[model samples]
Target chain A: MYTSIAGSVARPSEVRLQSPRPSIPPSTAQPEPVGSAFADLTVCRHSVTMSDPRAAIVPAPAAARATDVAIELLAEMGQDFAGSRSIGETLRRALHRIVDHLDAAGGALFLLEDDGRTLLCTASVGATNIEGIRVPVDRGIVGRSVRSGRGELVGDVRTDPEFFQAVDERTGFVTRSILSAPMSVRDERLGAIELVNKRGEDPHFTPEDLRILEAMAASAALAIVNARLAAALVEQERVRRELELAAEIQRSLLPTPPRAGFPVVGINVPADVVSGDFYDFFELADGRILFNLGDVAGKGMNAALLMAKTASLFRCLGKTVHRPGALLARIDAEIAETATRGMFVTMVAGILNPATGEICFANAGHEPPLLHRDNGTFQAFPADHPPLGIAEGSADTPLPEATVHLDGGTFYVVSDGVTEGLTVGGAPLGVEGLQDILREAGRLPPAERLTAVTSVLTAGPRPLHDDATVLAVVGGSAVTRPRSGSAAGRREPASEELVRVSVPSCADRLRLLRQVVALSATQSGCCQEAADELVLAVDEACQNIIRHAYHGDPTGQIELSVHHQGRDLIVLLRDYAPPVDVSRIKPRDLGDLRPGGLGTHLIRALTNRAEFLPTPPGGGTLLKLVKRIR
Target chain B: MNTGMTHRVERRQTGMVVVALEGDVDLQSSPEARRVLLDAVAHGGAVVVDLSKVGYIDSSGIASLVEALQKARQGGSRLVLAAVSDAAMRVLQLARLDRVFVIHPSLEAAITGDR
Candidate 1:
């Protein structure tokens, strides 16, 4: 009364039964009688079915044994996985248990990849280096089980048409049978668990084994999904912290607003946590103030880095390069060397003379800054050349320089983000809208005007889609608070006989000399052209002293005297340096096409009888330049 | 501090390189101007420096032109000044360099080697 079943007992009714003491078919077909100890045991070949009367009596106990084993295995797997540290370790332990409990040669656990069309073997047991192998999701028997969301039992995989032999070839392991079940949780199929070969006397996997694997797969899928979510959250947090640190560093590089008495105000607001817009204004060594506003090409960390480098370069080069065009050319060369592909900057830089409310600016492919005149009108200064970093070296066309006399007026510069900002109706604010805002704020002070512009931007229905930056320079009547020791605020009395000023012999210091000479020339009724010539002559005289007498030493002293005697304007420039040889003081031949030796020539050409005389007591050179009014 | 200046190069059909200069070429920009002029001279052809747009030229800028002349002589070419501004013409007259280089009133005249 013993029976053995093999090759997946899919239906219990398929096994025929025979009575022990009854006439069955023939004497040759009689079943062998078993002892009491083996009475309930049933054995059947993988391809054959036994015909014994008591064979049906043995299947009940065999089915019950399979159920007990499946329940025990699932309980043990849950406890083992709860103690595992990582998803990979849990899967490795589960694969080992599945192979050992099912009496199989080897097993592999594959997880679905993010792309959803492939399965990656994350853990393998009893296979040679099969971990990390990839298989298409719809290619093999394992794929079928995962796709169908069911367990598959192939008794003799060599005959099963869906059996893929690639894994066997890759791992060099022979596969006789396969039992695969889909790993899924709540109707979501993650991957599949595959057992390669049956190892016990049965030699083929049973249907009962397939049922147990499917149950264990459900628990494993849940554990893996939880671990993956945790890892992703940790990575997200790390990236968020790095961005915040980058934003803080960028914020420190921004310039702060000047305290009271200064007429410049600048502000920047970032669309993201970091900004690519920057503005800076600082007084040069001379009394003239230098200011610049720039916008980098893009947003975020790369743009912020370039913005910092550009601002720092302007500060460093602005001290020596008084010309805005030259400074911008140098900056363009530097940025072109190291900037990322498709990266460039648009900038507007200027120098302002607070004494006369005169401002000169150079534009480099930036939005034309608006000049708010004292009469409450706005004029736009357009871009003169291509943006920096587009080409190497100086621009082919002159960088446009505009001189505006701001008397109780303002000069406003804004990034495109201000004009392109959106309104409640999804329409762009445009340049006209900006003009309206600037006109309204024209009556307010410099700081309050900036506030009004910012309030309009933030109070809009839609937030800014890009970084916004604004810089305003208030001039003329607004600049009544004169700096200490500045002669611009002092008016000489008609009875005063003389006005004298002394300055260091430097290129930048020449501006002060020009200012004082301009005042004297104007007082003497010299026309505008004559006044300009007087300033140019004095500047050339001092430059000659610095270049020739002092040999470019900026620390030397040059005493300048300006006096209006009747209808003639007189200017005396006396330098305390080694006296130049008067006989050799001649302008170079212009036909020679040389760069030097023009300073002395310019001095003589622009003045009325320029004379170089010997100083009696000081032993230096005395240059007297006179301009007579018509 | 008014060091406003700009420059550009144009190649003519007659194989002359015309470097047009504008604004004030002074001590601040003369070195760069010198490098540009010398580079043009090294190319070994008739080089014309157009100063039509130039409002002023200082001693250092004039020196750059002189250096370019020497380089052009060594390179077997000629250097000319064209479209010299009135403010710059006064400096040339005072320096007497007007007699040195072939001066032309326009870039076209300089390219055709016209006086």
Candidate 2:
């Protein structure tokens, strides 16, 4: 019987149940028009019930013979499945045994694909090789059996309207009768087994044969389901290992941590198996450190892939581009060309000269990179342009660059993840929270400081919803702590011009301006106490402009410029409000004890001279305050 | 920007509402300082402005203290400043309010009414 089976069909030594049917050519099989009630139609008319006592007592010799064949088929299938792990081989051997026992001309075993949309011929025996052919789940008698979860029997195929003749046209096999039984375990309809043209004098399949086949299909379905589960678990493990390898590769792509006290350092905390946020800093031959921090728009593999592309592009092009604004423009053009739709990166790229304490950078719609002066105040540089990939091509105009002389200050560039990350109180650690963290962490070394600041969101009990990244660049120049009266350890400004900035004449913006003045005074070789005095004087001057000149109009503009010359640091404040009479702007008597008059007195006391300079061309007042460094 | 690193208001068991100021209390933060000071003064009780952590204070801050002191005077409440840093002290003395308002060398001294 085994030799006959080998001759019938060229079955492989090992059968993979779900292997792709690449060997089989596309069949010219046409679909059959099956009536909605085709499942109700059966060839088993005049069926004898073995459960009836009369039928069992007067059982025909043929019934006894059929019972013996059923036993042999079941026993053979049990051994065939238990001995072989190859599902296709077990199924093929079982199909052959069913054909041999039922005296059929041919047989085919069809199983539903994973999608359950098509029935694929997994095994075939005798006459025509229909193995690897796929029929839609809505076509043929096998489809009806599987969909309806019932056995189908057609006594005469030529007259049966539900009979599918396309297989015969292609394979040239004549079929007289068909018996197909659904292979199912409980509610799960696995597939179906179909036998064609019983080779006997009767020439038709009987109800008894259908019942025996249904029982056999049940056992085959259970075995097939188990094999499928085992295969799926193996596939899942393979994918898991591949992801771990990919994560390792991603980690290796990041630059190594700098030495403990290195001015520039970064940290990244990923939310998932991978991160979409990235930061990089490298030193150029000119003794300048180039650094960048970026966050891709989305999460997971696509964002990770884009992060790699953007990070590597920055490292490669950044060396040659030199200028941060132009380099970011080039990166934006490159990313816009191939980036996935609806995805963009918010990034800030900058270069810092540790010796000069000068930083030149461009913000690309990222969070405002914070500049923390040693005075315990913050100056945040907001993005002047849209993020990368949103602006399609390189701009004809040079991208705007923000240059700051971080004299004894630390500049921080961070992704929004750090700002948006939840704190221990389950609220977002906003910019204010970051400021508080930096105020304390600023004293630590660069690498340790990044860790200490980021740990607020990373080490908390609540999970991070997004990736958090931070990059810090500490300035080289040193300044005396505020109120340290003597100029013991202070550095002079590198050049005469300290800082010139224009801001809206609003109360909210005065803090940054005050910090600028304070930094300028300290940079001009004043002690911390003198710097504080200068900051106080400038804050009073700006408050006077906002309250008396602008009349508390928040829309008015104020342009302030500080310059260092001789022994004095000069502050020039230009406001859009109409000029005020210098003589009439006298401080009110100190005994008045009013909120409106103290700003004026403080200005005169802190500076050596407070006078309105010549009005600018724009019909606005220019107030200059000179405080000689003592 | 007010990270509670700058200023905080707390009630002491000695019936004094101490407003602790830190970092820079200039034009930007003086209004908040004034609000906290005025709120303490509005209680019509003894109020102490803690300047131990204050690095710098402009006239705007001094104005808040003066206005709060005037309100305390109108309400017949005790108002004093504690731990005034030299920078703040200079601003107060420049305005000559140092001679007007009672001042303390330490917070404990102020809480104990030790001047």
Candidate 3:
């Protein structure tokens, strides 16, 4: 009876599974006792016999047998799947179990591709190197089952119009019957599971077989979803760490606030983890301060990197180019050669002379900075050329510069984020709004004024969409006049008769020493030439202590005292550094042609008498410089 | 007044390039001064850097001038410093580089290769 059943379903040249021995091979078979729960799960062979007349009619016992086999197969698959290390491995094991349990000739598991228009065969059983085969998502019976989220059972390829024969033609296999089910987790269809050519006498698949295959597919789908989610989470974590590092590097690149008496303050706030805005204020060796504000074209890591590079270039070039227009031209040429296409920088650079209240500024496609005059009015100096990195070569027209006298006034530079910030009503705070804010806070000092503007701009609950940067330069108080005026032309004595200060031996403090010396010399009735020479002598003495006696150690303290004697103006400098070798302190030969070791020479040349003596009750150096008051 | 340092390069009728540098050549202004001086050296002719207006110079400024001197030698040309300011000359004397280069009292003297 079984022989006739097997012969009736066999095709001309199709590989058949030899069955009726045990359902699963002994190597993979599990022990089952008689009358156990899985006893009804004996492999069913379709045949015409006294007890069963129709081969396709699944009776109550046959239905029970299919359910029992599906349950046992699933239990075993769960264990093996849990032990699998990779997604491919899990899918491979699942496909093997499905083909073995259903007694099908072969099976393949197809997964959705990233494009979502095609399915790639990720794992396959009974096929040699057929992995990575791709088929259109809507092309075959497998595609139909995936689309409908249902199982398809086709008894014969010739009778089923939806059956796609291309796979068979490609793989050189003949298809007799097929059972395919969509693998879906919740509402998302991941892919499809397809089994082909049921083996033994049961070439035709029953509805019961389709039901069992569907249950297996559901389990496989759940595993696939879990793996993909794990992968996505890892990728997210990696990106987060990279952004954190980028933010740290950006923060380190920001410049520190300028010292007191510099009349400059700057602030920056990023809209995201990193900002593309930067500002800097540093004093040049010529007593002029160089200040700048810049904004890169975009946000995030790329923008942050470009901002750092642009700022560094400005700092290095700013030291060389005193004219703001010439500096911008050089920066533009450098950016054009090094910056990526489509990326550029908008910047405003200027040099401020505090004593004379003179400022020379150049703008490059940036927002016009507002110059608040002492007369309660503001003027905007707009860009004269495009932003840097956008054009090749130097600007056609000389980068126009605006010279403004900033006595008792302020200069403000802001990024676009200030004007484009949204309010509660979703309206942008235009440039006029920014001007109003500045005007209201104009009464406050430069640093406090910057704080007031920031609070108002970022007050709304809605976060800013970009980086906001503000730089302000306020003019110094009207105290020191230009050194060009001769002291003999003055009508009044200096404001102070005596001045003394104790400060750390640092290069930055030399300016303070010069101020005190100039005051004392003027009060003593010394002419401008004599007073200037007195100040230079004292400055050179302090520099020697800072550089030579202290070896550039800022922790060392220097005491400066300036006073007028009966016929001599005297300046005394004392430091607690190691005692100097007075014998070896002679100035270098003037005929020698090199740099350095000039502090002693300048001090001696400018002062009537410069004497180096030891401090009382201590091991330190005390320098006394004097000039006759005529 | 424009107190900031400035430079200009001129080609003399005698085929010598004269780079006139004005202002203080300290740490802040050495880079620009370097560029101007080096360009004169690269032009491959007798170069004279006129420092008549330079009132001050630091070690960094001297280093730039030395670089110009080296470049002039590599290009097989003469480099001379003219009208050296007292302040700048003192620094050059201290560093002992004053003996290395040809020094002249004025631009005309440098152009004529006078001592």
Candidate achieving the largest TM-score: 2
lDDT of 1 by residue, A184-301 (tens): 7777779999998798788888776776677667667766766677778888888778878877876776666676657678888888887888888888777788899999999888
Per lDDT, the best of the predicted structures is 2
- Summarize candidate 2's per-residue lDDT along A272-323 as a digit string, tens digits: 7788888888889977888999999999888888988999999999888888
* Model 2 bad stretches (over 4 Å): A1-90, A113-118, A132-140, A158-161, A200-208, A395-398, A424-426, A440-449, A452-463, A476-630, B1-76, B80-86, B90-115
TM-score of chain A of each: 0.63, 0.62, 0.64
Candidate 2, residue A611: Cα displacement in angstroms equals 42
Return the top candidate by DockQ: 2
Q: How many angstroms is the interface RMSD of candidate 3?
A: 5.6
TM-score for each predicted model, relative to the true structure: 0.54, 0.58, 0.55
Fnat, one value per model: 0.64, 0.75, 0.11
**Pairwise TM-score winner, candidates 1 and 2:** 2
Please give the TM-score that candidate 3 achieves against the real structure. Answer: 0.55
Residue A448 miss distance in model 1 (angstroms): 3.5
Say which docking band candidate 2 falls in: acceptable
Instruction: Kindly list the per-residue Cα lDDT of model 1 for residues B1-115, writing each as its tens digit.
Output: 5556778988667677889888777666677788889988887778999988876666677778878998888888999999888877766665677888788988878877632
C-alpha lDDT score of every prediction, in listed order: 0.73, 0.77, 0.74
DockQ of each: 0.28, 0.38, 0.07
lDDT of 3 by residue, B2-111 (tens): 32468889987777899988876543466688888888888888899898998655555676888888888888888999999886786566456678878999888888
| Candidates in descending lDDT order | 2, 3, 1
